[model samples]
Target: MRVAVVSESFLPTVNGVTTSVARVLEHLQRRGHEALVIAPAAGSPSEYAGAAVHEVPAVLYRRFPVGIPTPLVHRTLADFAPDVVHAASPFLLGAHAIGEASRLGIPSVAVFQTDVAGYARRNRLSAAEGFAWRVVNLVHDKADLTLAPSSAAMSDLAAAGVQRLARWGRGVDLDGYHPRTRFEPEVAQLRRSWAPNDELIVGYVGRLAPEKQVEAFSALRGVPGIRIVIVGGGPSESSVRRALAGMPVTFTGPLHGRELARAYAAFDVFAHTGTEETFGQTIQEAQASGTPVIAPRSGGPIDLIEHGVSGLLTDPDDPRSLARAVTALTGDAGRRARLGEAGRRSVLGRTWESFGDQLLSHYESVGARGPVLTRALRKVDVD
Candidate 1:
């Protein structure tokens, strides 16, 4: 099957959406499916997983670039004539791709990965929150089928009247991020550099942006024998650095591949402060690395973690709650080990192969149903 993937975010941008898309494209190629990527200009390689990537012009927005649709997009899709269009977090370029697909009577699928309404509210654009929801509804409603990464996100979209909603979870590279990686000499040395002593290491990985609520991590400062390691970079790095001043915190610009895996493996406790996440990929990666996580009790973490069972979920609005969770997990090695092991076991089956197969199955189902029948059935199901 020929699949055209449209995304506003891609290579050169280290985020969950790009990571997921890259893995999916690789899986598609391994399975002998023709895949093409249409993404914003991020100096991305011309070819990925043997799939040709078409870079569209984009403008810088907040932390990353937002793709703008051009006539070339229509031409590319027209020439390739994909069997289905997969919009990975369809917003800018994705929105255009879906529009063109609709014009050509092509079946398209949109994935809801970001919370636009929540973002607006976080940025103090409260007046624009309703407008953001309307835009979200417009885009997802246009697609033949829309995929939400978490149940919480699906519920939000349903409440907003978005149609044809379905759940599509994320996958983790277990082999790349296992407890065994921590035994590597290089990883051990990396940990020494962060702590320099046998201090507890609390880690956070993701964009250091305002929406991520990274500032809340400062609450972990001044805790006895605890060092905070923040991995990843963004527009808010300077502010984070200033906010965490005089604390035992180390900011590693950005790490990928083995380096990224080592960072996760070295963590004594992984912390995520973001509450607007559709799905927290870092939380899964940390678990895959055999590390206990402390994430907020809101959004996707609520589904990923079973409080006090696999990992601890604290109050999203309380920084002190996050600090307390970290402190409690740090002092109890036995409990932390149990939670980490269970967390790893929980996601053992969530491989990239399974994710790709499920996505392909959805595509086939939507294709077989056809647009008219699919929409009619979706309406009946939603009604």
Candidate 2:
């Protein structure tokens, strides 16, 4: 099958959406399918061996690297003429994807990966932020199928009138990220030079944006014997530091390869405060490293955590709840060890191979008109 995967963000810009999209494109290509990408030329697509990447000209917001803010990629997608269009983000690029698919009489799909409105709410916008949900539905309304990454997102898409919705879920690279001990002589040297021994290092990974509620880092100020470590660089880094009142936080500026693995290994527990993750991935990475996650009981984390089993899901808005959860996980060595061990295998079913096999089934059923056959059967029953 000729597939076109369209998105505003791609590799070179590290985030969950880009990572997941890249993986999907890889799978399609590995399965002997021709896959092309329509996205901004901001990043390198050479990583995917057999996939063709066609970048369109677009303007990225000066302050925000996560989005292009405004773009018109319709012409690009139309030129590609793919049999199936997979819209990774349901914004301008997504609209173009569905529009081109319709013109070509092709099956199109949209993947829901983030909660824009919840992001807005975290940024302090109330009523105006509600439009994210509306926009999500409007974009997918044109698709033959819409794939939501999480059950929480599925409920929202359904409420917004996306009738033909199914879950594609998310996956983690089990090999790229695995349990690795021994912080090496170099990493250990860097760690010793940055932080002293016996400092309870608590790690937070992902963008340092306002929607991420990174200011919540201040909540850790009162946690005794704790050193806050932020792993990703983002727009709000300076503001976040100011909000933290020069609190002690070591920003490793996004580690890759073994350093990243050790970053996960070094942390005693994972603390993610963002309420808008479609599926918080750092939680999975931390878990893969046998590190317990202390996440909020909102958005996708609710689905990722089982509270006291793999990790503890606390109140998203309550810093006290976050503190308590983190405290509980870190306080007891035995409990943390058990939870982390369980979390190591938490992603047993959520893998790329599994996701791709299931998704291929959906694509085949779409091509075969399974829905039409089902309705026809229902009518015969009535007869």
Candidate 3:
């Protein structure tokens, strides 16, 4: 089936939205399905996995591109005439696209990946919380189906009065980020470089944004025998660096693909500092790498962790909970190994292929009532 994926962010951004969209594009390409990408113009590639990428006007907001409203969305949809529209982390641009799709009598699937209301709370924009949720509700309300990545997200959307909601989680790269990577020569060398005196590595991977609460890692300042590794860059880099000052920490800016996998494999414990995550993608990557995880008992992490079974869940309200969880695992190699192994086992069959197929099923079910049944899966009309 032909699908048009409208994402709030895309390549060169490397956040959860971009990562998931890229994986979906790759999946569609592999399954012989035609696809098109509509994203913000932030130096993204012209094409991905054989699908042509159409960029729209965007403005920099907090150092990230935020797609602005444009007539291009309506024109593009009218031209391509996809069977279904997949709105990835629907926000301003996404809401507009969904509205356009509805006007064109096309079905849409809105994926609720970002928590804008939660972000408002984190940024102390309490007044904007209601407004944010209103926008979220309005955007998702138009879709034929709204896919939420976690129970927390589903609950939030439901509370906002969004209907036609379904729980859809993100997939991990099983082979790329596996337990075997720990034994790789490159990973070993990298670990040695980060922890010269053989310190336990407590790592955090993801953007250093304000809503991410990355500064929470500051509580680990005096922690013993653990080197903190911060991967990924964002607007909050300077402040986060200041917060982690005088600690045994190393910032790797950002690492992708094999390097990102190696970073996860080298960690003794993966510490996710973010509290507003709609879906903890880094936590999954850490689990896939056989690294014990410590995430706050909030948002998406709640669904990903089993609290002392597969991994540890800390108190999101307590600033010291993260540091304490890391301390508990720092001296216990056996426990960490057990937790890591369990985490790896938990995600064994949760691959992109399986998730992609699940997505196709959703498309088929939704498209069955629309133009997809009669129209052939063909190339999009660029003109």
Candidate 4:
């Protein structure tokens, strides 16, 4: 099957969207499907790795320096003639791709990855928040099927008027982010730089941006023997660092593979304060690595955690509350071990392979919308 993936974000970007898409693309290739990734040009063609990338041109704003804009649709998509267009987000590029798919009688699937409505308020686009929500709903409404990473996210889309919404939950690479994965010597250097002693290492791994509420990392400062290690770099790095000026925290640029796994393994507790995270992928990785997570109660964690059972979820935006939860979890080794076991158990069956199979089932259902892409291509050859 030929699937065209249209997304506003892709490789070279270290965010949840990029990570999730990369996993899906891997499984798609393993299943013998050809997937074309269409995103804003980040670098040379070789930068795309395995998948074929169509780089459109766009300027990125300073604050959100990592985001690439695709203001127009590329004509190459029509030439390739995808069987199904899986559009990620309803941004300009994604909207253009989905529109073309509908005009060409192609089946389309839309993945709702973020809450752009909430983003508007944080980004000072309050008046446009409703507009963003409506545009996203319109895009998904036209899709043969729309995917949300969590049941809560699916409900959010459904309530916002996306009719064909369904859950296509995220999957973690158990091997990639496992307990045994070792740390880089630099990470040990990092641990020493931050802790300098036998301090309980608490961590947060994600974008260090305003929307992510990174100030929550600063809340654990002076909490006796707690050291914060924020993995992954972002536009908000400098600001987050300034906010934590002189605190016992270390910023390890960005880590992958063994270094990342070690970072998770070293964490006595994982913390995320974002209220709008649709599904926290990092949370799953942390939990899968036998680390107890402390997240806000508002969005993603609602699906990934069971509060007191597996982990704790406090009031979103309440850093003091998050700090208390972190303190409690890190203070009790028995509770941390208990939550760690339960957390791993909770995510045991939710693997990427299972997610791919689930997605393929949904694709077969949506791909059946027309005579199917294969049959259409065969007719062209016979002609």
Candidate 5:
């Protein structure tokens, strides 16, 4: 099937949404399906995994660029004439694609990847939270099917009155992110360089955005004999640095592929402070690397972690809760190793291939259902 994927953000941004979209497009092409990507211009390659990428004019939203979809989107999509449209996030560019697809009477699917309401709340836009929910419902209600990346997000969308929702979580590249990487001499040396003096390495991977609650990590400074390594860059980096000043924090702007995998493997404990995650891909990545995770008890982590079983979950609102969780793990090496082992086992079969297969099945079902309904209507008219 010919698929059109529209996203607000894409490559050169270095975020989960961009990575997921790129993987999906690549998988579609590998399966002999044609895919077209529409996203904001970010100096990304014109073509990706054999899929043609069409970039629109955009402006900076914090550290990332937000695409402004104009009327030309309709014309561009009409020319492609996709069998189905897949809107990733469906806020800005994706919203326009859904609107155009609806006008064309084409089957469309929207993936709810971000928590806009949570973002609004984090940014102190309390008044905009209601409006954000309304906009989410408006955009997703148009799709033939709406995919929520986590159960928490599905619940939020259902509460907001968004219809046709389904669960669609993320996957980790287990090949790259595995326990074996930690034993590698280079990775061991890299870890030694970061920690340097028998200090425990507590790492956080993801954008240093306000919604990410990266400032919450500052609370970990009170934990002795530990080094804080934050991997990823965002507009809030300066603020986070200032907040974590004079602390044992090392900022590694951004790392990808093997370097990223090595970083995850090197961590004694992976700390995720974001409560707004639709699906925490980095959490899974950390688990895949056999690193115990300490994520908040809200959003995606609620689904990913099993309290004391696979990993630990703490209170999202309280920084003290995060500190206590980290302290517990740091003091008990046996528990940390056990949690890390169990964490690895939890994501054994959760791979990108499996994720793509499920996604493609959903697309086929939605695509087939549309024509079947049309045929049934025609039969009724004839009778």
Candidate 6:
């Protein structure tokens, strides 16, 4: 089947949306399916995974490109005549594409990967939250089906009155992020450099943005026998540095491929500070790396982790929760090993192949909707 993917972020951006789109394109290519990627212009490649990428005019906002709505989107979709449109993290660009797909009578699937409303609330932009949800509902409401990455995201969209919702979680690279990487020479070197005194490494991998609550790492300032390693860079880097000043913290900026896997493998415990995550992809990476995770008992983490079994969950409302979780793991090596192994076991069969098949099934369901099929796509367990 031919698919047109309209994404808010792609390539040079390298966020969750871009990563998801890349995986989908790769899967489509492997399965001999044709695909077209429409994204904001920022010196991205002309093609990826055998799919042609169509660049659009965009303006920079907070160091990121925001695609300007254009008539080109409609013209492009009309020309492609795709069987389905996949709207990744629908916002400005995605909204326009979804709207155009509706105009062309093409079935479109809008994937809800970001929590715009949650970001508004996290940043105290209460007035903007209502407006944000309004935009979310307007964009998602137009699509034939909206795919949510987690139960938390689904609940949020349902509460906002968005219809035709389904659950669709992201898949991780089990091979890249595995338990054996810890024994690699580079991983050992990284662990030594980050934790010179052999202190337990408590790592966090993600954008150091306001919504991520990166400053929460400051709570571990007085904790003993642990070093903090933050991966990924963002607008909040300076403030995050200031917040964790004088602590045993090392900022590795941003890492990818083998370097990222090494970081996760070298970690004794993975603690994600963000409370507004839609799917918490990094947590899955850590779990796949055989590293125990500590995340807020909110959003995607609630679904990804099983407290006291696979990993630990802390209260999102409590500022001391993360630090306490880290401290608990620091002193118990046997429990950490048990939890890490369990974490690895939990995500064993959740490969991109299975997820890609699920996505294809969704596209087929979209094609089989209405008169062809009496009911819409049935929601299924994400396991």
Candidate maximizing TM-score: 3
- lDDT of candidate 1 over 1-383, digit per residue (tens): 77889987999887888998999899999999888999999899998998899999999888588999898888787767677899999997898899988876568999889888988877778779989999999988889999998989989999989989888998899899898998999888988899898889999999988879888978887688899999999999999999899999999989998999999988999999998999999999999999999999988998999999989999976779988998897789999899999999988999989988999888987773343553454344335
Better of 4 and 6 by TM-score: 6
Better of 1 and 5 by lDDT: 1
- Tens digits of per-residue lDDT, candidate 2, 1-383, equal 76778876786777777888788887887787777777766766654647777666666664433334233454444454455678887677667667766755567877877677776677677665768767877788898888887788888778877789887777776765666553456546655655686666788888887767877878777777777888888888888888777677787787877778878777877889887777788888888777888888877888888888998888876778877776665568899888888888787666788888777776765572333443353344335
- Whole-model Cα lDDT per candidate? 0.88, 0.73, 0.89, 0.77, 0.87, 0.90
lDDT score at residue 379, model 2, on the 0-100 scale: 47
lDDT of candidate 6 over 252-321, digit per residue (tens): 9999999999999999999998899999999999999999999999999999999999999999999898
RMSD of each: 4.9, 6.1, 2.5, 3.1, 3.7, 5.6
Model 2: lowest-lDDT 10 consecutive positions: 63-72
Residue-wise C-alpha lDDT for candidate 3, range 1-383, written one tens digit per residue: 77889999999888899999999999999999888999999988999999999999999999889999799988787777788899999898999999987876678999998888987887688889989998888888999999999999999999999999888898999999999999999999998999999999989999988888889989998889999999989999999999988999999999998999999999999999878889898899899999999999999999999999999999988999988899999899999999999999988888999999999888876663344532432223232
lDDT of 5 by residue, 1-383 (tens): 77888988888887888899988988888888888888988887898999888989889867688889897687667667677889998787888889888877668989988888997787788789989999999989889999988889989999999988778887788998999999988889878889999688999999988888899988887789899999999889999999899999899989998899999988999999998888899999999999999999998889899999889999877879999999998889999999999999999999888999899888876763344453444344335
How much RMSD separates candidate 3 from the native structure? 2.5
Q: Cα lDDT of model 2 overall? A: 0.73
Please provide TM-scores, in order, for all candidate models, with all chains considered together.
0.94, 0.89, 0.96, 0.90, 0.94, 0.95
Error of 1 at 215 (Å): 0.7
Ranking of models by lDDT? 6, 3, 1, 5, 4, 2
